[model samples]
Target: MPTLRQQLFRIKPVPRQKEDVETDLKRTIGLFSLTMVGVGSTIGTGIFFILSESVPVAGPAVIWSFVIAGAVAGLAVICYAELAGSVPVSGSSYSYAYATLGELPAMGVAACLLLEYGVAGAAVAVGWSQYVNQLLFNLFGFQIPHALAYAPEEGGIVNLPAILLLAMCCFLLVRGTGESIVVNAIMVCLKIGVLIFFICVGVTGWDSNNFADFAPFGISGVVAGSGLIFFSYVGMDAVATAGDETKNPKKTMPRALIAALIIVTSVYVLVAVAALSAQPWEKFDGQTAGLSAILENIVGSQWPGTVVAAGAVISIFSVTLVSIYGQSRILFTMAGDGMMPKLFREVNPRTLTPVKGTIVVSAVIAVLAGFIPLNFLAEMTSIGTLVAFVVVSLAVIILRVREPNLERGFKVPFYPVLPVVSIIGCFWIISSLQIITIVVFIIWTAFILGLYFIFGRKSSVLGKQLAEAGPTNPESARTDSTGGAK
Candidate 1:
């Protein structure tokens, strides 16, 4: 029998069993729809209000913050592309760590992803409530009462709209991935069009003065702003999360990731610049519905604002849906690996989807969205995503060193250097976050690790597989060892 240290550090083989894989998730996502998933998830609610958070710090140079954050995201995603091509699994960074780092590390990555997807779903839903009310009042001159529309911290009883949004998303997800992708694609197009409308109209009122105070806080300010704006880039990894369901994930995953990054980054930069040129960066401080407000101020009318609000309502629903979709799949992957309960891995025959997982995920996030204030959720998400990115970058380097001959459809350019820079960039942004956010993240991760010690280590499926294979079956046992390439 292997010692405790060896068992904890054992790796899951890259090769999967036929029975283990054949009847699980279906491969219905193509490159285009996968790209739409990434775009839909990333561009939500952030652009609608991010300027208010980032602009005061960096002034007009908040534009550079967008680029910096995008660069970090792109580098990390490139690493993800390489790993997704190599592993082609569903757990995103978690599975990558299991294949390269070890079981304990994989669980660590899972801790971060739970925050990234599950909490982010709730957080994004909470933001969606505001836009839903805005759209309602804009169209019908009626709005959900504050008591029903906000969490207690926001001076409301419960965020009913957020819970309602989560319910709608859960219903669609339980139906099937194909249908969800189609709806998300439509929303992506509609929201992109709305942003373009804002850009075209806002540029008409361009004032040169906005650029005068550019870099008012210098590079330090730009970096700080990048840290804040990093939240917008969180969803790109959701594309990689679809590896198991993606058609030709090796090619499709990388193509969709790069395409989504280009599209999201371009849209973010253009919107930031247009909004900046139309008004002084100083005015962005404490602004709500930043994009819609900018359009209204530029055009001297409420109609453009109304149009943006409606688009936000439609677009943010897609974000919440994709977030919930991602959370369920990650849980499904974990359950399949025996890290979570089997109910999460149970597929519904009618839909070939993890129906129970989706419902459970939606219910948990619904409670959070309804009862918790999301004022800190954005920062928490950024930290979680950044930490996960750091691990992906490390996994790329480790896999390259260990599996030198392993086949990869996509490889990170500049090899180890790019991955290292990606790690450094992630840490650079991480250091700029509030001390309290970092402390809270550490506490949350500790709590998860505690669970791992209590239950996961005892029940791990990979550990059991290795133990049953034993020393007598040398080939199978070797295949299960850490950093072992097949």
Candidate 2:
């Protein structure tokens, strides 16, 4: 066994030579498609369902929560922008960690991403189920049975709609990345258009009286709500996941990351303000499809609500697809790095995509969607993203010192200050999470890390590099198609 210091901080950073990066993925996605991926991924289940949860916690001050969450997300995305400029790969934060932190730290990052994307996919699927039921009811005056529409804890046997949505995404992914991302971009535009519609209609009912006692629960409530809404911003990092497949990554990466972050934050803030102005915050409690509920209550008609529900059905479905795509690709990258099973890394020669990996991810996400409550899964995703953000932020600092002369198409403005603030922001957001959530995240992380020590550590591609190359030095190994330095 290696010494504690060696195990903790061993540097197995990948060589930055172009030939060293093994990739079969096509550089197809342009900046617009990439930006849409971030927007589509970020503006999903959180906005659809979390509003109902956050309003009860922070009342009208939930608008501030959106701003807080956006600021933190922006900080993290800036750090990711700088790193993505330097390391163009598919693993997002996991790839960044491997290239700068080392094998052990990379494993930790892989575990967090798996947890993050997996649960996020499931959470988004669950939210889709709600909107599906809402649309069905609005269209036909009847809805799916409670037992088939919710988790067991919610008095349901299984969430069939969520499972079906996962299956649809799996099919889309197996078709190819080019097709899926284009479809995802189209759906993103539709959703944003609908959100704009909601804001326009909702504002018509705005009364200044609703703003009274905006922060009834005080600063603590705003802070707590920020933690919940942070999940809404979790998927912006999905943009960085496209580095390997993006056209002109160094240029496209930073632009898409910033564009998506700004667009999404603006939408969330606008929607929150409109919704708060529509009615007293107390009315938001116990509301499902919160935005639609607000619209319906104001218009005194079901047509507006029906339109919103229909829009949600489309939007959340796209989100589930995009999120599941991100999850599958991350696992594929890990498998290539030898951190996971080879089955996940295998890309279909016909489609030039990881069909098996996509199926595996969809199946797992389907199970979680069918059984777990959205609330639990959303919390797990937020925690996982928070953990990954901190790692990526730290990696920015590490890479700057280790590779001072590295070419960076997009340098993070403000240098160390931005990255440092990003780290602090992540910790602050995490501090507001429920103690139970923090405990569960700790236990889940330990379980993943434990598996690494037992099996992954010895089997990883980096471990083979250490065995064959004699020593683990910066120049000793080269990264292969499988993402391991050998």
Quote model 2's TM-score: 0.93
Judged by lDDT against the true structure, how good is candidate 1?
0.86
Report the lDDT tens digits of candidate 1 across residue range 139-209. Answer: 89999999999889989999999999999999999999899999999999999999999999989989998
Off by over 4 Å in 2: 1-9, 18-22, 212-214, 471-476, 480-486
Worst 10 residues of 1 by lDDT: 477-486
Q: Candidate 2 — which pairs collide?
A: 336-482
RMSD values for the candidates in order, in angstroms, are 2.6, 2.3
lDDT of 2 by residue, 79-155 (tens): 98988888877889988887788767777887788888888888878988888877888888898999999999888
In order of listing, the candidates' clash counts read: 0, 1
- Displacement of residue 95 (Cα, Å) in model 1 is 0.5
Stretches off by above 4 angstroms in model 1 are 16-23, 472-474, 477-486
In the predicted model 1, the residue pairs found to clash are none
| TM per prediction | 0.96, 0.93
